[model samples]
Target: MTQSATRSGAPERVGRFELLVPIGTGGMATVYLARTRLIADTYRYAALKILHQKLAADDGAGLADLVAEAKLASAIRHPNVVPVLSVEEDEPWVALVMEYIEGETISGLIRAARAKGERIPQPIVGAMIADVLAGLHAAHEATDGGKRLDLVHRDVSPQNVIVGLDGRSRLTDFGIAKIDRTNATATGLVKGKTGYMAPEQIAGLKLTRAVDIWASAVVTWELLAGERLFHGEPMPTMLRIVNEIPARLRTIEPSIPESVDEAVAQALAHDPSKRPATADAFRKILVDAWGNLADPAEVGRYVQALSGEKLDRRRAQTEEILDLRARMTTVTRHAEASARDTSSSKKAPGDLPTRLESGPTTAPGETGFASTGSLRRPGRTRALGLGIAALGVVAFGVWMVTRSGANVAASPTTPAREASSSEAASRIVVFSSKRPIVAVRVAGRTVESPPALTLGVPVPTGAHEAEVVAADGERASVSVPADASQVLVPLEPATSAIEPSASAGAAASARPTGRAPGRLQPPAKATAAPKDPGLAPPPY
Candidate 1:
C-alpha cells in the first residue's frame, strides 16, 4: 500500500520489480501488473500480490499465511498449476510475486458465455475440470525432504481456475490451502466458497484431500447445469449442502450421460470415504466420458472466439506499459545527470548542494526531456537544456531511422570486412498495424506487435509473407522481398472474407458481430508460463 518515491519524484519501483498499474483489490492483497528488471533492455511481467498493511497489522498470522501460500505453490510444479516466481519481504509490506495467468478466470468465462446466450460446452468443461484435477494431484503429491507435504487445496472455486487462450486451465491462489502439520486452515474453522464447499467441510470435521474432490465435483455440476449446485446465504447454503439430497447431473441436463452423472454423484458423496480416492480418479472418469471431444485445440478455439478482441487490446496495453518502463528509466537518468551537474558546479566553500524541488517539469505527453524554466540558475539551467536538447536530437534520429519505408544501404566503396559485418547483422522486421489492435503473424507464426510502431524490422535477404489478422478473423497478407527491411502492414477494419462464389453481403452477414467485452481495469502483463525458478531463488 506504500508508494515508493525517490528524491527525484520518479514513478515507484519496488526492488527490481516496476509496478505498472493496479489491476485488482481483494480482501487479502492488492494485485499489480508488474515487470522484473531481468537484464538490461529485457523484462518479464508478473502479478505482484502485495499484502495490505491493515490486514498484516490486524492479523499477524495473515501475513505468515500469505508467505506460506507462496512457498507451498512454489513447491508444486506442474503445467496446470500456476507458479509463484518470487516473494518480497520488505518494509511496510510483504509481497508474493507470482506467475500471472494471461487469461480470464473460469467465473469470468462462464459469465461471458451466459451473456452470449451460450452454455459452456460439456467437452470444454470436462477438459477444464480435468486440468484442475491434474494440478491438484500435483500439489497433493508434493513432498519435502522425501516426505509428502500432504497438501490439500481448500479453495477450488471457478474464480481460482484460469483458462488460457491456449486451452490450458491453470489453478491459482493457494492462500487457503491446508498443509499437513500446519495450522494453515485450522481444524474447525470453515474456509472456501460456500457453493463449492464439501459437506464434511461445512460440519467442521477433520479434512482430507477428498474435500478438494467434492469441491471439484461441485464446480463440474455448476458448469454442466449452468446454475449453482447450492444457493442462498452462507448458512442456508451450508445447511442445504448438509441436509438436502443432491440432484443427479442428468436431472439438471438430460444430455449429460449416465456414466458422467454417476461419477459426479460419487465425487459429491456426503461421506469423504464415499468420494473418489484421489483427484486423478475423478479426472480419469470425466476424461473418458467426454472422449476425444475434449480436445485442447477445440477448447482453445472456443476461448479465442470469445476473447480475441480483449486479448488484442491487452497485448497493446502491455506494450504501452513496457514503453513506459523505458521512459521511467530515461527520466531517472536525466534526473541523476541534472543532480550531478548541480553538485559539481563552482560554489562557495562549505555550501550545501543546490536542491531542485520537483526536479524538472516535462511537457505534456513528452517523456525523457524536460521543458524550459525548470532550474533557476542561468549557467546550470543552460547546461541542462543543452543536454536535454541533445537527447531530443538522438531520439529524432532514431525515429527517422525506424520509420516505415526508410532505407539504408552500404556504400559501394565500403571495406570488405565492414560489408561482412552488415550481412551478418540480424535483419529486423517491424510489424505495424493500421488498426489500434491487430494480431500480426510472420511466416505463419504469431509474434508480439509493438504499440505505435514506426520502425520496420530487417528480414532475411529473401521473399517473405506477412499476415495481419483482425480479431474477427478477417486477414490480409502481403509479400515482401528480404532485401526490403521495412514494410508497412495496412490492417483495415475486420470485414467479410471475399469468397469467389458467395456475394460480399452474404460474407458480411456470416461474420460474427460479437466483440470481446472490454476489461474493467485489467492487468497488462500478468506473467504465466514462466521458467521455473528452482526451489530457492533470490527473494525480492
Candidate 2:
C-alpha cells in the first residue's frame, strides 16, 4: 500500500484504506478520500471517516457512536441513502468506510447559486427534496430481524444531503440518529442544528420520525427562498423555532407555486400532530403540489455546470492516486519475486527446507496477511539449506537497499551505532513515542510525524532534547542518549479539560468542507423544563 502526507505529516493509512486527501473535518472525525485495493488491478473508492484520536481516547462513547452510525446506516439499503461499506477500529483510530459520492452537497449548491445572485430552480428543489424524503422514509420504516427499527435521523440539514454528479440525491451521516435499539441521545441532551430542530425537539420532548420531516422542510424552504428559514445565534434560533411561525415560501419567493408553499408550511407546523405524519406522506404532498419534477439527468447537468472546475480537479487527483498505487504494487511484487527466486537458486539439490502447507488466502474484509503451517522434515541438510536460503535473502535485501541509495546497517532490524564526534555523521538516532505524534523537534529541526500505530523519527546521531507533540496537543520532551541510536518517549494522556464540545460550535458554523455528509453541532444542554425539572449534564 502507499501513504500520503497530511499537513501534519500524518501517515494516512487506516486499516486497509489508503487515505488520499481529507475531504472534511468535524468535531469528532475527519472524512478522507480513500480507496481499498480488493485485489491486484482492482480498487474501490470510499469516503473514510476516521474518529479523531483524542476523541477516541476520551472514552468508549465516541467509538460506540461510530459503530452505531455504521449499523444504523447499513441497515437501510436504498438508492437515495449513502451506504456504509464497513467500520474499522485500529487502536487509536476508528473509521467508517462508506461509498464515496462524487458530487456537490445541497449546501454547496445553495452557496454557489447565492454567490451568483440566483436561486435553485423550484422544480430542482422539489425533485432533490423528494429523493431525500424517500431515503428518510426508508430509514424510518427500516427493520431488524423483521422488527421495526423506529429510526429517526436527528440531523438532516442541507449539509447532510449530497447530490451526486449522477443527478441523484442521497442522504447520509447518521451520527446523531436515534433508533429504538440504541439510546444514542440521552433525555435532556439535544442533538442537531438549532434552526432545523422541531419545536418539540428543542423543548427536549420525545422525538419521532416527524422531527426529520421538519428539518427536511426547512432545507426545502431555504432552497426555494434563497435564505435561512431561521437565522441567528443558538439560543435565539431555538426560541424562534419553538415560539414563532415561519413565513410561507411563496411570500419570500413569489415564483413558488401556492400549492408547494402550502405543502412546506404543513410540514413545518409547530405541533407534530399538525405536520405530515411521515416523510413519505410529506414527499407525496410535495410531488403532487409541484406537479412536474426535474429529471435526474437535468439536475446532473446543472450540478456539473456550477461545479465543473472543482470536480475536474478532484477527478485528476483521484487518477493520480490510482496511478501511484499501481506503480507501488508493481514494484513490491517485483521485489518479492526477486528475493524468492534468488533464495531458491542458492539451495542445493534435495536440500529444500520444510514446505509450508498452504491455507485459505486473505478473504474479503480481512486485514493483514494470512498464516500457514509448515510441514517439518527431519534432516540437518534441510536446516542447513534453510539457513543458506535465509542468508541469501538477507543479502538480497541489503543489495536492494544499497541500490536504492540507503545506508545499510550491519543488521537490517537493528539500528546503526552512534557516531563519535570524530566520525562522520552517518549514524542515526530514531525517536518514538507511546502516543501518536504529530511532529518531532530535535537537533534544531522539526519533522512532521504520522498518526500511525507506531511512530519512529530518525535524526543524525547526537545528544539533544527532542520535543514531541501529540494530535491532542499534549507535549513531552526526552533527552536523547549520546551513545544510543533509539529513544522512546512517553506522553501523558490528554487532560480532561480538552472537551470535544469546545470545538463543536466552530465545526457546526463552518461551511461544508468538500463533500462531507453531516452537520456536527455542539451537544446541546438539556434546557430546564417550563416546570423546572432538573436533568443530568450534557453528554460531550
Candidate 3:
C-alpha cells in the first residue's frame, strides 16, 4: 500500500535472505514476504521486518523499543509466535530477517469478504482465532525464572492474525506487543490496536496477564460477530474501552449462542480480577461451541438498530452471563503449573473462577500443569475457610523450614526497598508522589523492568530498591527502597486514571518529544509513607 518504500532504501540481501516482496508496513516497521535461500533449500521461508528509516531518528522513543523488541523476540522460540531469525543494522535501516509466514491477515480476509458481500464461516473463524489465542498463551507463559515473561500482544486485532493455507492461525507482529517484565519499557504513545484493549490497559493501570486475556476476548468477539465488537471509528472505540462498561455478545452478533455470549462477557469483564487470569484459562472457557464470524446479516441488524434505537443488549447480556455461570460447576482451583501455590487467598463469594495471589505458600504436591477439581466434604464450607486461614500459618512454617541461613540473607526485606530481610531490610519508602522515574537497575539487574515507582509489585522479602535513573542520563538515583513486603504506588486516583483516551490528545501532551526525557510534570506529590503502601492521587 505504501509505494515500494523506495527501492534505494530497501536492502538487496540480508543474512542469506532474499528481499522477494514487501507485504505490509505499520507505524513501527515494514514487513516483507520472502524466502530463505540457504545453501540447500531447507524448505525455509520467512518474513523480513525492517525498521522504518524515519523511526531510526531517535527523536521519538520508538526506535529504542524496536531495537529491544528485535532482541527480545529473537530469543523466544514458539510455533505460534513468528520467529525472529536474525537482526542487523544497515546504515539507513535496522533490518531484522525473521521466519516469513505466508498467509493473509484476518483483516485482509474480512475486508475482501465484506467487499464481495460474503461472510466468513463462524467455526472456521473461531478455530482460526483459537489457534491465535494458543500462540498468545505460549508467549504469555514463557519464562526463564519464577516470573512470567508476561508478553502482552497489546495489538490483538484482525490485522495481526494470519490464517494460513494449513488452516492454522498464526500471530505475527510483536511490533507493539509489550513484554511487561523486560528491562526496557515503552511509555508515551499507548501500545495496542484500537477496538481491542482491556480496561486496565485503557486506564494505564499496572498491566497484568489479565489484559491480554481481555484483548483476546475482544478479538474473539470480532471474529465471531462478523462485525466490530467495540465499534465506533477510533475515538469511540477508545471510549468504549475506558467507559468501564461490558458489551453483550448477542448484540454484537445476534446469531452467537447464549452460552458463548456469557463466556465472552467474562473474558471482557471490566475488572481484571473477574476475567480469566490466563490465556490457557480463556482458551478453556471456549469450547468449540462458539462458532466464528461467517454470519453477515446476523450483525447487520445490530448496526441498523444502532443507527436507530439499539436495545439493552449490553445490560441484558451482563445479567444473562451471571445467570448462565450459575449452571457452571466450580471448585477451588489448585495451581499446578507454578512452583508456588498461593491458594491461601480467598475469592469473593461467587461461582465464577477468580484469581487469588497470596504471600508465597507451600505445595509439596506440585504438578507442572495438571490438577483435579477434587471436591471437599459437603456442608464444610466454614471449616474449609478456617483451613485456609490455618494454611496461612502453615505456609509461614514451610517458609521458615525451607529457608537456609544464606538464602535468608539473600532475600530482600521489602517488595522495593530492602536488600535482604534478615539484613534488617524493613524500612519502606515509596514515591512521595506518582511521577515518572526509570528503573536503572532491578535486583542486581536480574529481576525485570520495574514500574517507574512501586505500585502492584509484591515484596517477597521485606525490602528492595528500583534503581531510578534521571531523565537526562547525566546521573541516576540511588535505589528507592520500600520496606513493606508489598506496595501499591497508584499515580493519579481512579477518577482521573483514564488518559484523555484520544491518541491525538495524548500526542501533544504525553508523546515523547525532542526535549529531554522524564520532563513529565507530576500533577501532585505523594506524601503518605505507606507502611503497607497507601494509594496516591489518580493519574491523568
Candidate 4:
C-alpha cells in the first residue's frame, strides 16, 4: 500500500478478502475494490460491501436490511444483474461479496454527457434500459421451491445501474427491494429516490413489479432529454409524480422517434394498470419502438468513449494492489503461521468463534435475521475465524512494515511474539469535551470528529500529545496519559476572553475513566442560552 493509502486508513484485509481501495459509500455501507486468492498466483476481484460499524452496532434494522438484500439479490441469476457471491458476518463487520464490474454507473454517464452538452444516443438508451428490464423481470418472476417469490425492485434509477466496459449493463443494489413474503420494507416508510419513484410508491400504496417499469421509463426519459423527469424537493417531487403530466419525450428532443417517445410515455402512466403489466413486456415494446437497438458492443464503446480515463486509472489501481500482494506473500504466510500457533496454544475465552456453523439454507423472511434466529448457521464449520485471524496477522505485519522501514521480507521470526504483546497492550484514548469538537489531531494524523462527539484514537502504550479544535475555532493542547483510556478536554466559550475553568482544566489533565470505546453515553439536556443554535448537541 502507498503512503496515501495508509493515511486514508484503509484496512489491509476484511475477513478473507484483501481490500484494494474504496469504490463507493452509501447510506449504510461502504463498497471496496477487493480481491481474494483462488489459488497460488490466481485471484478473483470483487466489490465488497461492508456495513458501517456505527450502524451495525447501533441499529438492528440496518443489519437486518442488509441481510435481506443479500438473500434476495443472491437468488436471481441473470447476465444483466450483478451477482452476490456470499454474505459474511464476523463481529464488527458484515459484508456482501459481489462480482466487481469495471466501468461507470449510468448516473455518471448521464452527468458526463450533460457536461459535454451531448445527449446519449437513443439506441444506446433503449438497449441499456432493455437490459435492466430483463433483470427486473427475472427477479419479479423468481421462485423458491417452485412458488413465485413475487419480488419488486422498488429502487431502480440511473445510480443503481452499472454499465461495464465489457458492454454489459447490470442492475445492482437491491438494498430497498421488497419480497412479498419477506416484507423487507416497513409499512408507511418511503425508501427509493424521489425523482424515480412511481406515483403509487410515493403515496405508500402496496407496490408491484410495475414500479420498476415506471422507474425504468423515467431513466429512459432522462437519458434522451438530458434532464431529470421530476426535479424539486422531496414533497414537491412526490406531488409532481402524483398529479402532474410529463411532457412528451419528443418535445424535449425532437430527434427522438415518435414511436419511442410514445412507448416511454405509456410506461410513465400514473395508474399501475395503465403501464405495461411486466418488465419483459415493457422491454420488448421499447426495443421494437427503437427499431435499431444498439448491441452490448456498441453500448460498451460509448461508455468507454465517455469514461476511458477513469477505467484506466481503476485498472492501474487494481494492478498495484495485486503487485503489493505478490511482494508481501512471504510475510503474510509467516504471520498466518504465527497466528495459527497462537490460536492453538493460547485460546482466549472471549475470542470470536473460529467458524460459522452451517445449518439449514433458509431464505430470509419478515423478521429478517430474527427469522433465522441467528446470523450463523447451526452445524457445519465454515472457517470464519481463520479468516479473521488472517486479517489480524496481516494487520500486525503491515504495522511492522510501517514502523521498521518497509523491509517486508525481513523479520520472518518476529511476528508471533510481537503480535501477542502489541495486540494485547494497545489501548484506545477516548477524547470528550463539553463543546462541539470540529477535529482532533494526534500522532501526526488529523481526523474530523464523527457524529458522536467522543473520538477514540488507538495508540501504543505511551504518553502522546493531542490537539483539539472546537467548532468555534478555539484550540486546546493537552497531554494524554499513557495509561488513561478516556480523557475530557476543556474549552472556553467563544465570546469569553478567560481561559477554561480551573476544575475543567484539571479534569482535562489525563483523567481516567472506565467507559468502553465507541459507546455513546446520553448527554444532559442543555437549558442555557445556545451560541451555535443550529448545531445539535452530540448524542454523546
Off by over 4 Å in 4: 1-10, 180-189, 319-442, 445-540
Q: Can you write out model 3's per-residue Cα lDDT over 1-540, one digit (the tens) per residue?
A: 011112113443454554433456666676754455445634355677876555666574566666667766765666667777777565555677666553556786776567556666666666665677788888777665556566666777778876643455677777666754342234444667667777777667787778778877877777667677776676677887788566687886787788778887888888788887778777766754563432324333322322111012212212222222222111011112111222333344544533332334435457544433443333245446666655555444323321311011111211434224443322212221122222233344311111122211112333344433222122223323232221112222122211111111122233232432323221222122112112221111
TM-score, every prediction: 0.61, 0.62, 0.50, 0.62
- Number of clashes recorded per candidate: 10, 1, 36, 2
- Highest TM-score scorer: 4
lDDT, candidate 1, at 253: 96
Question: Model 3 compared with the native: what TM-score?
Answer: 0.50
Give me the displacement of residue 427 in model 2, in angstroms: 17
Which window of ten consecutive residues has the lowest lDDT sum in model 3?
Answer: 404-413
lDDT for predicted candidate 3 compared with the true structure: 0.49
User: Clashing residue pairs, candidate 2?
Assistant: 11-450
Question: What TM-score does structure 1 among the candidates reach?
Answer: 0.61
lDDT tens per residue, model 2, 1-540: 111211122234678877665555565676777777888957778898877555666667778788989999999999999999999766556789998988888988997788678988888888899999999999999999999889899899998998987899999999889944443344344778777889988877788999999999999999998999998898888888888889998878888889999999999998899999999999999999999999999999989887664454445334433433444345445546655655554545676565655545665457564544435444544456666665565456544532321211121212345434543352344343333344455664444322311223345644666666554555666666455443444543333212111111232233222331221112222211121123221111
* Per-residue error (Å), model 4, residue 124: 1.2
Each model's lDDT: 0.63, 0.66, 0.49, 0.67
> lDDT tens string, model 4, 1-540?
001110012245677877665566666677877778888967778888877655676747778888888888978999999999998665566789999988889998997788678888878888889899999898998777788888888889998999987788899999878844443344444888889999988877888998999999999999899998898888888888899988898889899988888989999998899999999999999888888988889999999899875554444334433444453565568666866655565544455655554456456674364333334421112245555666677777655533332212211212234445654455445554434444465654443422222444545577666776655455667666564444445442243222212121222223233433332222212222112213221110
How many backbone overlaps does candidate 1 show? 10
